[model samples]
Target chain A: MSAAPELNPAIEVAGLRKRYGVGDTAVDALKGVDLTVQPGEVIGLIGPSGSGKSTLLKCLGAVTEPSDGRIRLSGETVYDGGWHDLDPRALRRDRIGFVFQAPYLIPFLDVTDNVALPLLLAGRSNREARQRARELLAALDVQHRAQAAIAQLSGGEQQRVAIARALANQPPIILADEPTAPLDSERALAVVRILNRMAQQYRTAIIVVTHDEKIIPTFRRLYHIRDGRTYEEAGAGRDLG
Target chain B: MISLAGRDILHSWGKYAFTGLGLGLLIGVTLSMAGIYRGMVDDGKALLANSGADLWVVQRDTLGPYAEPSSLRDDVYRGLLGLPGVAHAANVTYLTMQARQGKREARVMVVGIQPGEPGEPRYLIAGRQIERTHYEAVADASAGFQLGQRVRIRRHDYTVVGLTRRMVSASGDPMVFIPLRDAQEAQFLKDNDAIVNERARVRANPALNRPGAPGLAETVSRSQESSRMVNAVLVQVAPGWSAAEVAETIRRWKRLQTYTVPQMEEILIAKLIATSARQIAVFLLILAVVSAAIVSFIIYTMTLGKLREIAVLKLIGARNRTIAGMILQEALGLGLIGFLVGKTVATLWAPYFPKYVLLEPGDAARGFAAVMLICALASTLAIRTALRVDPATAMGG
Candidate 1:
């Protein structure tokens, strides 16, 4: 496994395992899960409650260490049995982005700043970061709300701004956890459409963790996790474009 | 990077303003307490300065006319003036009592001094000094006395002939100057009934009414009715003589407790008001602790309320230091506003207090630094909580 060539997969995992506690109290949250995502691809990860969907997302996001796994991003091994010599915070800032169930836009920041935050954390000049944020906001069709406060935006607009923020750093991978849990069918489909467009335009791989039945049919490929194990399947491939 | 603390404060400025206002009032009271202590010390110094005395000759082994009771013969100034360095010496008495004017009564320190003496008030802001020794008085302006107004002291009514400013006692009581003879009579005069009873008791004693000593009873009665005791002797040193040198000569030769101006100041400030100073210090310490506790509670609660947002920030790659800095900055901002408000209110209300309140710039500067330090210390609790937020918690596992 150590001699494997760098295939440049946006995100890849094999035999990822996460166990809580030790001895009799030990419980496995993820049991030898394997996954792969190609560039410019948007994949759906769906599962029932307590089925380790979030556990897998957490492992891939580099927010938590896996007990045993081989993980790679952009041809670099991030976790091989144990985490490599990389700052996890820098990994999240420069190589990965996250979207939550709620837009979770920083309440105090306007649209532009909320989008520019990741770039700022990555040591970009304020002007350059804000300029990059503006360009992304324009691409997301939310340029008109660049200076609007988070509370001023409608639910769908807030979600679009959140997507812009996730794509701000140009990360190779984005982990969106239930990105449309609060939206109706129309807004939910619109969010999925935006995510797909952003992934393709930016050449980024995105994994969307969701329980929304309405948007399940849109993905070309899907991963279903049951009891800490993943089963891959082909989706309905609905034409969302 | 955009200032997360500034944005958060601006977002909920109303909450911060109200909280700061409450804390500011507490700070205001703390400052005022400190001001009162300073005022007391200044009053003690002023009293010593206005007396225009180089040395104070008090009774042997006594603290003095201010801190303790000290009685000397009224003729003690005669012997003190005979000393080599003594330019002029005057007997003086001090008694704290109530002065009644019409329907109001004011607490005043009655000072007995002879006309043209070192113990007289240095300057008068209004009217003339007392010319008629028996029924004339000079009062401090704080006593609310008007010229020619009759004020009752003891069993006699004396007209206020002059008003002086800042002529206060060590305890901040306004000084009222009267003739030494009148003050002596007032101090020792007994009620008519008591005097009559004393006379009968004396006549009834066979030893005192001895047939061989006919005029002895009359002489003893006359002596008992007269008061010749004074509290202290105020002395002025001649040119080319240091007050310390003169005071030391009096202490050694006259067998009396003598104090130079600086030594008297020490007695007045360090000894007289030491307890009060300690009390204010304790109050300031308690207020500081309370302010810190309040700031900690508020910052901790505010941070706890943002736990979810903090998780999201951490997950999005915000460093621990950055998050902690945000919380710390908010606490400091609150403290700044509170200090400004507290200083303003304390200045505005200082003059209305009964005792003088001296708000010194040095004290204010020290207070501001203390407030900042307290705020910084208080923010640590909130910062610690924010730092402990696990980024993985954002995944809801």
Candidate 2:
């Protein structure tokens, strides 16, 4: 029900600029970045350190405002001349999902509750939210561990649960900042494989920010960022094992 | 919404419980301090109530019987008995001294009470009241005296024939009631050597040793050796008469210091125990400050420890109110646990204290409210810290 329109681009950004501080001391973190992603696509944003990948992700996630940009998410203008007529907190809650290097699942909550938290926060009934979470766990192949505490899960299973959490609210865009950074090669590839399958199945666009070499070739498209700008590249789209 | 605070507490219950236990001991000390003050006030009231008097008559210009020294002729009660509206009046003496039983001694208020009169203790728990004129005594149960125990006061050893409960002085020393003649002797008795020296001084006087006054010196010596003074006269008014009227008549006509029951209660509680009450008050304030500081430090440390998680929750769209609420709820939870443990601990240890510890329900309710309020205020620092955590912190550089 929260999916984007069938034909429109899932995310749109043009001349997006972000600056830290103000007046003479202000330093630009993101400048003139343009990107677009249609529904049901998973792309990579790869660069060396200090390339404004995080800054751009912060802008896209609505956590930080862009100084100069025309941004749209799920066919709605989120940041234009200024902020759009929508609450940023609600936008992040209902429209955007984030996956960091660590799974970052709340340790106090069990896996099912962790995945179900987003829905609960959006005012869904407990039974309905948990039911949806179990469905997602089954799809991610962690259904057996749904009732377990987060500490009891393996690294791969925790990441899977984290992805399920991100998908709970059915956000059209999931900005993954190095979701596989702490994993071995096999686990990293498996995470990418899971992301691609989720994107196709749910018609969600995912932007994975990574410096990992093992999963880089799996993206059909890659946005190589340097000096706060992006240069798109085609990937091998190799068959996942 | 899910109760984030509840989940967190359940996850780390041991940490919460142990911390609460430590805080509970502090709260227990605080409550016990308050109980001590109440006990002092209660002791003063008990001293007044156990005397079975409607009015107190002492020497003029003195705080009679409990707070200050006073003395009057032992025969003053006869004049008081003849006064209009006076039902009964009897002489009573109060002397705080150490009573010895062989090797054991305890501080006691030795009260010289007239038998079958207004000064007798109201009820007895063991044995009979004083029947002898010289040496029978009734002891408070708290004095650790048994029936038929020989209690030595000054040079004379008396038999404890009766026991009473809750009969204490304004200063919390247990009461030991004896007959009036024995108490007067104890108050005015001198050593035989001093008596002999006094007798020699009296007989050596030329006017007294003259033939016409041959026996006068001996009579004077005997009179000097005997004492007929009492500290206060306890008066009971007739059923149809007002004690205040009788007290006023005594004060104006007889020229004596007289106080009605309520006025005497005020003197004993307000004047006698004022300093101890203030001391306990100072202790209570210090304990409150210490409890607040400990709670604040604990909550602040807990908030700091979970900064990362807070940042993640913020980035995931948890509101500022939600995060702050979690911290506040946790602080209150700690206070509730602490109060429960403290109340139980205070009750369990109250009897072991040397002084009577009176834990009133009203004071306990007020203490519970104060603790909850302190906890709520203590959580503010942690709440502020949590709110300042930037949502962007969850997105690492």
Query: Each model's number of backbone clashes?
Result: 0, 0
- Given the true complex, what DockQ would model 2 score? 0.69
Chain B TM-score of all predictions, in order? 0.96, 0.97
lDDT tens string, model 2, B99-166?
Answer: 99989999999999889998798899999999889899999999999998899999899999999998
Q: Candidate 2: deviation at residue B115, Å?
A: 1.6
RMSD per model, one decimal = 2.9, 2.2
Model 1 agreement with the true structure over B67-158: per-residue lDDT tens digits: 99999999889989999999999999999999999999999999999989988999999999988869899999999989989999999999
Worst 10 residues of 2 chain B by lDDT: B205-214
**Which regions of candidate 1 are displaced past 4 Å?**
A1-7
What is the per-residue lDDT of model 2 for residues A102-164, given as tens digits with 9 covering 90 to 100? 988898899999999989888899999999999999999999998899899999899999899
lDDT of 1 by residue, A1-241 (tens): 0112235778889899999899999989999999988888889999998898888888888888889989999878999987799888888888998988888888888999999999998889999999999999999999999999999999999989989998999999999999999999999999999989888888889999999999998888899999899999977678886
TM-score of 1: 0.96
Model 2's alpha-carbon lDDT is 0.90
